[model samples]
Target: MAKAFASQGDTSEKNISFTEIGAGIWAFTAEGDPNSGVIIGDDSVMIIEAQATPRLANKVIEKVREITDKPISHVALTHYHAVRVLGASAFGADQILMSDSARAMVVERGQEDWDSEFQRFPRLFEGHESIPGLTWPTTTFSRSMTVYLGQRRVELMHLGRAHTAGDIVIQVPDQNVMFTGDIVEYHSACYCGDGHFRDWGQTLDAIRAFEVDAIAPGRGDALIGPEMVNKAIESTRDFVRSTYQPAAKVAAKGGSLKDAWNEVRAVCDPKFSDFAIYEHCLPFNVARAYDEARGIDTPRIWTAQRDLAMWEALQN
Candidate 1:
């Protein structure tokens, strides 16, 4: 039997965990689902990665209320995926922040991406109607920006592009904790539908330079300790390299995209089959890697129509 498209069959709810990995830094993880970060400063809170909808974000808010009553004053997005940014309204943050390039992506393909993602993963958008349409950042920076929540300092830096052209990491320099959006995944599969494989590897190297005690990834459990941190980064790099290299090899041989897709699944599935969303991401990952290997640097927009067509062509 053919597999379900994307995450359509993934209706089971995951157990959420709120872990404190640093001084006032919390990681809100939901069993390999989209994860969030809560940085409680001396005065207020800074949220990283809004959930898929206002309804879903409320759960995170409830968790926050359990810890501190400080109003959430800021939100930082790592990239422009719908599941990550569409829930901004629930936070009531004065400053919704992202890299300027991420803002450009929102302008370029945000609507199509929203449609595509919603169609691909209906379970994630349970309260789709609550979404106030496309989310835009109130503050945009090019390279890096620093914010002070009273005495605590949070640094937002574009470490280099990986998951998206404008991926950024929120670093609590003093605490040595990093909230890496989708740039890195632990046991969860890396979603590379809009990724730059070559650039992603280099970006991982840059992330390795940081002396981190804990990391809050886009998905998966909070990685605590330098050992686990290195493992996650290396595992993420391995996933990207392993997926792309085989597809690139096939493309270089002038193989069909379908052939490359099959090749990637054969090689990757054995190693990554148990990872979260591994099945949902493989087709898109293979498609993007095929395009990139064929010298297509920029990823094509994935509208809902394009999504179905590509899935059918590759998987059916």
Candidate 2:
């Protein structure tokens, strides 16, 4: 079960669960909550993603301690989202790894994003001051990097651009499990503020090409079996299409952004009524999808003021 809380105010769920996806992989997920994954090896451990702050990371560390006594050796950041990468120091890993693009995003807007996200989501950053600094990747790879935790081999690869320019997936070949950052959310809404919709579908295809039986997405429930695995993929696809087509039609027809949002809200709200963070994601998704459909090359960086402006414009 996933326990959820939507920031500090409004609605939230509790009792999040960490499901063991494979022999050494465990996923801590809450409905509408940010996710963190742990991979324990024979003598050491590698955490897939870190929570937003040390306060939250401690809770995850406590969970991992209950399962293994091995020290956390590496922290692999899937992308550079503040909620996902800001708390790198909490794990106290030997190394933190990420793709080149993620590092670039961090350098470009790390401070802005930190301020922006903290304002948007307060509960996730319970102890904001504990953060050491911007979570820069100690080790960075252009496309792929492979690490051997003792004898276990874990391959980290950047499939393509979908969620963000630097998105990566953690693949455990032996375990047949892939920890997909925000590329393949299961039962969780795609926060497409900086996403590539058409390209995102192709990225999902790239992920499916891998022979994965289990997966831990950026948020929401873990995909335990093959059936749920397929369901998550298909559901993500549906969510993408449902979010895009409406926006595309409006954009292509010269309709306003507000019109596109209305179209997306009308179509998606009913289908994804139960998805996590559906409301929070709607405004951002519509904004990006509308831009992509109109041929905007890169997503406009989301700022604190812009987020409020967009929310106020669409939510009413």
Candidate 3:
């Protein structure tokens, strides 16, 4: 291979930050790693997007402990990705919630994703053995659902497909803060292995319509104030468009996947080369963009073998 496969070369630990974006809403971020949201309600707390394993989830729990002692009532998974959902067991919340589509994806390719992700980035899965099995939601809603944590109202809604088919955003009406799983990233690359490039922008539009005050995004730093929030949304939109446009054009002209990849790199590198996980996510993003442009609506399941095959092919 030309370089390390995915993030295998990334072994150094990142400094973790727990920032309060709203009155009781916290964003747990680690450099550019996957993030988790903490919503402290009047009586209890609700967590959004569990980390990859129990060991990592404990980091978020430790931060949550610094604020309040309210028992975690619910763990809301924004999507069905292994890096996000596999850590649900660590929370032990009374209710593990997910969108109906997310639950179905769990049934469809949960194990495959776990295996693929673990192999791609071992640093995120520090304590892989601790993850009992595929995490399943205790409850699921089709479109949207409102959960009142005491007096706090948290709304989970599937605005549209972006990061994944089941991606959902958590909105706090009172504070006007939203926890957008992987739909909106701040100075970080969007991992689009299973993303819907066509629908991603529309999803961002739906979130924009809310005009929220702050957002605890899927990765990078927490966005506070409208300036930072809008910046992240538009940058994310640019990242997605920059990645897809070149690849789509290549596919439109009956170019090979390698040709599409080179074109995508030519366009995306100048703008997003410094983004977190840019190199790790590029190949998969290009492959999916090519597929989507070629009329593949649903993303194919990525297994460990497929990940290696794709990486090797792209390396050449």
Candidate 4:
């Protein structure tokens, strides 16, 4: 079943494209907005990456309704990001799954992340009142966990740190479909505020090692073929490199954050100018890049006040 949804901003229905990439598998994409993927197994369904709000998650459930009425048995959070996990209740899954590191992040700064993200991206959280509470994973693993929904194999692995300390990817072996949470984005700008720039590159390499036919990334379009998959992976790789090198140079030279931001804009803007959310991500990305360059391990907590201060300092 192929369907499309057009919102107010997306006058063209083509903005959102839903496709059955493999047997009993689907990718729900809306331009560069957040994306969700579905896997219907022998008896139950696994909903990956709950959308930012219940309203958004409904859009995913609507498509699942078209194919099969199997109840949502499990909900998986690729990492602990407010926009990703806060809507877990909407899925109504009996068990929620995530990496151990992700669970730790939730415990460490879940409240601050919730408040900070809500303040930054109200568009993603339309009906905050519906969010029951902070989502907690019922099941968590250290490195790799293989889940069996009867016969379908859903492999969850923590390859390396990328978007967040707990960043993980979902691989459907039979379908050859991989759901790379925020580890790999299609055309959307890579959000690195809580990312490890060095470890992120290795994570990308690990993701590419899998034999994937299609990919449902955390954002942007659903990559259908190997070509498109490679393109997305490389695009993500480029974003990370562009951010890291300049920040590293600034750190080496004892240059200020402002100077590094200037260098990054000079390099990245010319190439990634048309990417979605490029403007919104650059400030945050640069801030994290600067921190990593300065040898700051474990990203600093981002409160709303700190976010505004950084935005004002960098953007202005």
Candidate 5:
């Protein structure tokens, strides 16, 4: 291969930041790596989007400890992606929550995703050995579920599919701060290998309708006011559209996947080449965009072998 596969070459650690986006809402971000959210409620704390490993999750726990001693009673996983859910055990939360569709995806492709991501980004899985196994949710809701962390009312809703079919967002009504898991990103590239390009904008619209005051996005910096929040949402929308439009046009004209890839690059690179994880996510994003444009509704499960094979094909 001409280049390292995915983020395998990115071995350097990133500076971590634990920023408070709202009164009790915190965003634990590591440069452009996956982000985790902490919502300290009246009596307990709720975590959103566990990191890739127990070692990483401990980093978030350390920051949470700096603020309050409230026991973390619940963990809400927005989706079933290995990078986001595998580190859940570190929280020791009594209740692990997820959308019903997310749990189903875990049953279908959880192990495969773990293997695939572990190979793709070795740096993120710093302590893979410590991970017991796939993280399973103790409870799941079909559409929307409300959880009360003492007096704090947290709403988990499936706005629509964007980053993945089972993506859900956590909203704090009192604070008007939403924790959007991969559904919304600031400056980071959206990993769309398992995404729904068509429904992504609609999902963003749903989140926008709320006019939330703050947002703890899946990656990049925590968006603090209405202006920054709107900017991130629109930029994310542009990224998704720019990626899919060129590829969709190529597919419409019966072009090969390689052709679609070049077309997508032609459109996306100039605008988003500087975004975090741009190169790492490009090949997978292009492949999925091509598939979706060709009428494939569901994303194909990505195994370790498939990841390499796809990367090699794109390289050639």
Candidate 6:
């Protein structure tokens, strides 16, 4: 039998957890669905990473209400993926912020990403009709942008290119807690379809420099202590290396995509087979890695047609 396309078969709803990882900070995480972070400023609220749609984002809002009634003043996008940004309208945020590169991505391939991702993971796009078209950033910053609610400060820093050219991390310097959007997923597969493997490693190193007591990663449970935080970082780095290296080696040797996929699977499955979205991400991850290995610096846009063609060619 041919494999299902990406996460199409994952229809079961995951249990959502709204965890208070720091004094006024929280992580809204579902089993492995896209995660969002809440920073409760002294008088207002700031959300990091919106859910896939308005309806889904409402759920996060509900959780936020349970704690405080501060209106959501800002929404910070870690990158320019449809699942992460299309839900901006739900927040009704005063301003939507993203890195300059992320804004460029939204301009370049926003439509293609929306179409392809919607087709690939229907479950994630449950409230498809509710999405108010493409999410746009009202504010764009180059390297870092800092927002303060009262005396509480949250810094959005584009440490470097990793998951995407515009990946950003939200840091609560006072609390030593960071919300790493897709930059570091704990016990979850890093979706590398639009990633930079080589630069991703360097980004991880830069993230490690911060004295983080806790980290709310892109997926999985929140890391509460330094030990767990380091483990998640290391796990993410290991997965990035394991996936990219094997594929790059095969591609450099003039091997086919199938050959590269098989090579990576052999090494990754043993260690990461149980990780969330491991199977769903393998094909696209390998495809990008293969391209990068062959000197393709920019990742090609993934249209619905390309998604199916790649899956058909490497159906396991």
Pairs in clash, predicted candidate 3: none
Give all candidates' CA lDDT scores. 0.93, 0.87, 0.93, 0.87, 0.94, 0.93
Off by over 4 Å in 1: 1-3
- Tell me model 4's lDDT, rounded to 2 decimals: 0.87
In model 4, where do residues sit more than 4 Å from their true spots?
A: 1-14
Question: Which candidate would rank higher by lDDT, 3 or 4?
Answer: 3
TM-score of each: 0.98, 0.95, 0.99, 0.94, 0.99, 0.98
How many backbone clashes can be found in candidate 1? 0
lDDT of 1 by residue, 72-110 (tens): 999999999999999999999999999999999999999
- Model 4 C-alpha lDDT per residue in residues 56-147, reported as the tens digit of each score: 88888898899999999999899988888888898889999999999999899998999888877767878889988899999999999999
lDDT of 5 by residue, 273-313 (tens): 99999999999999999999999999999999998888777
174 in model 1: Cα distance from truth in Å?
A: 2.0
Candidate 6 per-residue lDDT, tens place, 239-301, comes to 999999999899878999999999999999999999999999999999999999999999999
TM-score of 1: 0.98
**2 or 5, greater by TM-score:** 5
| lDDT minimum window of 10 residues, candidate 2 | 1-10
